[model samples]
Target chain A: MENLRLLFDAPILTVQLLLDGILIGAIFALAAYGMMLVWGVLNIINVAQGELVMLGGYVAFFLFKAGINPLFGVPVAAALLFVVGWLLYRVVIFRIVDKDLFISILATFGLSILIQQLAKVAFSPDVRTPQAGFGTISMFGGAVTVTWIKIISFAAALTTGGVLVWFLRGTRMGQAIRATAQNARAARVMGIDTDRVYAWTFGVNAAICGASGALVAMTYLVDPYIGLPYTIRSFMIVIVAGLGNISAVLATAIGLGAAENISAFLFGAEYQIAFVYGLLVVILISRRIVLARQRRYLA
Target chain B: MSTATGKMALALASAALLFLYGPTGATAQTEGDTINLGAAVSLTGKYSVNGKNTKDGYDLAIKRLNEMGGVKVGGKSYKLKIVYYDDESTPARGAQLAERLINQDGVKFLLGAYSSGLTKAIAPITEKYKVPHVEGNGAARELFTEGYKYLFGVLSTSDYYLRDAVNMAAEVAKENGRDPKSMKIAMAFENDPFSLDVRAGILEAAKKHGMKVLVDDKLPPEINDMAATLTKVKAVKPDLLLVSGHEKGATLLVRQTSEMKIDVPIVATTHCDSAKIAETMGKQAEGILCASQWDRTLAYKDKWFGSADDYAKTFQKEFNYPAPYQAAESTASVLVFADAFQRAGSLDPAKVRDAIAKTDVMTFYGPIKFDETGKNTKKPMVLYQVQGGDYKVVFPSKWAETKIKYPRKLPTN
Candidate 1:
């Protein structure tokens, strides 16, 4: 009898979970886009990508404290993060651009720890959310309920993605960035300043992270330790979607989000992280095997 | 595998491992004007918030002790001093710092680290070194099951966190002429020791009180989202929503619950009394219930901080925020140390350990009585409702200030 009730209730629950996953997955996609841009252009796996998101969250946090509407925190956080990203590149990324790939990973990992500690000192360790007070709207006679802030965050992510695509396709700097990303030596030979392009790409990446962080601050709770998970999720999304594939990245992230939500439901929340990493491992291994088979056939 | 060469190689590996992580030598004992209490506080990492609060609690206790004519031991009056280092919220770092404090600093007495994980790490060091560690924050039941005589916990074990809340909710249900057996609960918690212990207690209490558990979910370790679980909650519409996911989980649950409008009769959680939840959620915080180990509204008093209300006022005046239960328990840990030191009448570690083992007294925080497991078994957990801006105790009528506002009314604007 109990089983029958649960079985009957499964449909509405599934619909609600699906909506929640896509909305949250949109945020994941936005944060992952930032990761993809930096990775594609710089060829450096930024272990501290999540820290930038954390810093962005802090920007929104302070702005909200200063009595600005938390919604306005989105753009303000972006602009501030742009400056931060530029500074980080000039000081750290510039010097280590030509170092061994392993060296960059280790350095960025250390940078991640440094960022977490700094946020702890600056913001204190209390968990905080800026409470946009957007309220909620029920759907399907309360079978599904959607928070307004989540909707706004999802819409903002789409708009940001749209703007980024337009800028990349139309602007000269975007073309230069693309050229540098494709062939840095050829772009430099063509009189394009590769160094400036790299810095701008990193800065824009940071700005994207900042905007994502503000939305997160409104939608989810922010803590100093929340960074590394975001970094890992973005990395997973990029890997699953492939580098420099923005539209695919967005689609894959939503898919991953829905999958995660469903898994969280079926397997319980304790296994959610393990499930994600497990999925990443499985995907990578299968991709490797497929490539090996393709290489044999080609030979 | 058991050949002579293999044995020799195994011995060499063991030696190398020991050399890498073995205990260092303790400096010569120096009895001076101050008694140094070493602590590996998580001051610079994930546990930094509670760590800072714990440190402030220690600092306040030490300051008050000095002002009131410090600990008198064996015809000598000595001031209390804390020698603390940031553990960075890592178990390994906490253990390493504990070793350094015990060996390099020659500090035999110890204070607890912030979270249960850190405390678990630091406990073994105290046991090996024969140091008396009085920890106020770490309350996981696993900490005491090791049977370490030298370690003591000042706070009640996490098993009692929701015991009172479940019982009171059952009682409140009876008062409203609702069937206790018909009352359903939705439980979600992080898969950590503290929260797991809380989950265990809620399950037991619910079973004992004849309440049906509609949903029991263990939140993911990183805890990024609660939407899926809250969605299930909305589907079931349980009469009570019980959660025990520490600070971050608690705040997220409250915010999302209000946003989703999963209007249960009660929204009781383990950490809602925290300023993080109360201050962040503001008006949405009203009517939420929290299972608190100690509340300022409780009718308790002591010579040091006077009543619970006085402690709140004094703590706010000094620290610029109302002291949470962590701070209160940390302060009580210090007081327990002081009480033991006075009773022991000497600075000897063994004597202090024995004195602490036999402690049966009361303070502003609660009664300080330890069972054989070194846990304060006498302290009863209290239930507090987030009424306006305060965590008002609303259970066990003797300690309660106001009757529990039955059937938590969600604000509809």
Candidate 2:
């Protein structure tokens, strides 16, 4: 009977834990969705994606400091980063995409280091945050506390995601991009300028990444080095979602969040992030095993 | 095969092999030969502030030693040259640098590393190479327990720093008529071995004072969202908060604490040496207490630290930041290495190890003597509180040059 009582009590903590996980998971999805898009179409992993986000954050921060409203700075930062991304793709990434896979990886990693070091040299490693607009809103008899800034930013991300999904599904440029991704040679033969599509796709990814960073800055402080961890977390989410599954991205994020919370509650906060990495290792191992078995069956 | 001539030749060949690969083969340096020391300081990462300061301290010591005509041994003075590599506070990179230092650089003495994880990672390479490692900044107890004969730590552990800070906090709480026993304490530490050792100290001290730890949290090394952690800390309503981490982590925590209006006094370990923390937190960091082995502002009239103030002053004048806690540690390490090499009267690796094992010298930090476990004895920690945005000695009043601020909150003019 005592054990039953304990079990009943566990659900309340579990629900809270899950809720915390899902909230953080939502943030991860927003952060990594751009990477998935860039990877799926361009066939080159954008290692500097996190740095682009950081650039966006700094832009928003400076704009806010210069007397612009933070909410208004998001789109402006996104647009600025879009142009920068477009230029970067034209100058750097596009030149290296056709190179060997290892070379491309090295180029992007080098680009990441260059961007990070540039940021370090230009803007010291001090933490920055866009000025806050609205405060927290209480929900569910005060059991849940949601910040207005978080809600607005997260809602904006969802809308942007929906708009992207719609554009890809319903627009001419989107169709061309999809066609290029599915069969580049076929699309090129049918009069699609595949190189132009790559540029546009890469620019769009950078713009979205910027928006995510700006939104992140509104709710959280960002230091120059936050990009590396963002990259790791984004890769963790994308890999765990089993690749090419958009909806599973959210599910993976939520799973990670819940896992982190449970680990914190049971094992203590020191092991919470460690718990997330452990789950990532498990997921990666399982995927490898599944792939090996499938390859054996095919053989 | 068993012929007498064959057996004699085989025995001779085995003897040659032993001479090349055995313990005696750990790079036999002659009395007149120069001893190479490898330094893998943080140099450029988050701990760069302290790492650079430590490097400066190291360079200054090495320069002074060389100017004194080097270590005199066997009727000759053989100058020491340090082959310094920047590990940038990454443990994996530190390990790689350690391997390079041992295998490629052929260094028999290692003298720099600030982070505990970095030191722990590089310690094994020293053991494998059969060279003595004189740790400068790291303070994890686990490093001492590894049973490696060649590893010697010069600084007090994170455990000492945290316990001293907490004990001081407890003293303040008791004096202010707050029930020290019932006072809620929150432990927020970085998720690393150094912080873990400090956390252990906090728990131990809290138990001693009968204080209840209401909240405990660990932030990742790359965490920037200390807002949530601060919120959790506030919810606990702790009378005291113990923070164990390095410069960046310390700065973020104090800043977030101010934003959340969590007025609970902070008790930090030796991680408070970074100038960035004071600059970032500004007014918010005032009154936060920390325990350390040495603060640059502290001057003992007759001590070696006082004598080294000119060296520390140069660093402060150049960088516009106070000298780091590890500066004295690194400086002491150079002195220890010089002393050992001089005592050994030879630069031979085994002889140097023996000399270091038998080291008994005074340094900037204190009287340095290594136990059988290669842990330094006579190393003591002092408590300091940030008063008027400057860290001032407050505890061990015998050594306290400034008046102690006994209660919480910064003293008003």
Each model's DockQ score: 0.40, 0.15
For residue A279, model 1's alpha carbon misses the true position, in angstroms, by: 2.9
TM-score of chain A of 2: 0.87
lDDT of 2 by residue, A232-251 (tens): 77778887775566677767
lDDT of 2 at A238: 80
CA lDDT scores, all candidates in order = 0.85, 0.72
Two-chain complex of model 1, DockQ on C-alpha atoms against the true structure: 0.40
What are the RMSD figures for all models against the true structure? 8.6, 8.4
User: Highest lDDT, which number?
Assistant: 1
Which regions in candidate 1 have their CA more than 4 angstroms from the true location? Answer: A1-8, A285-299, B1-138, B148-154, B301-306, B310-363, B368-374
Q: For residues A86-111, write the lDDT of model 1, one tens digit per residue.
A: 99999889877777889889988998
Worst 10 residues of 2 chain B by lDDT: B23-32
In model 1, the Cα lDDT at residue A52 comes to 88
Clashes of 1: 0
Pairs of residues at least 3 apart in sequence or in different chains that clash in candidate 1: none
TM-score for each predicted model, relative to the true structure: 0.80, 0.67
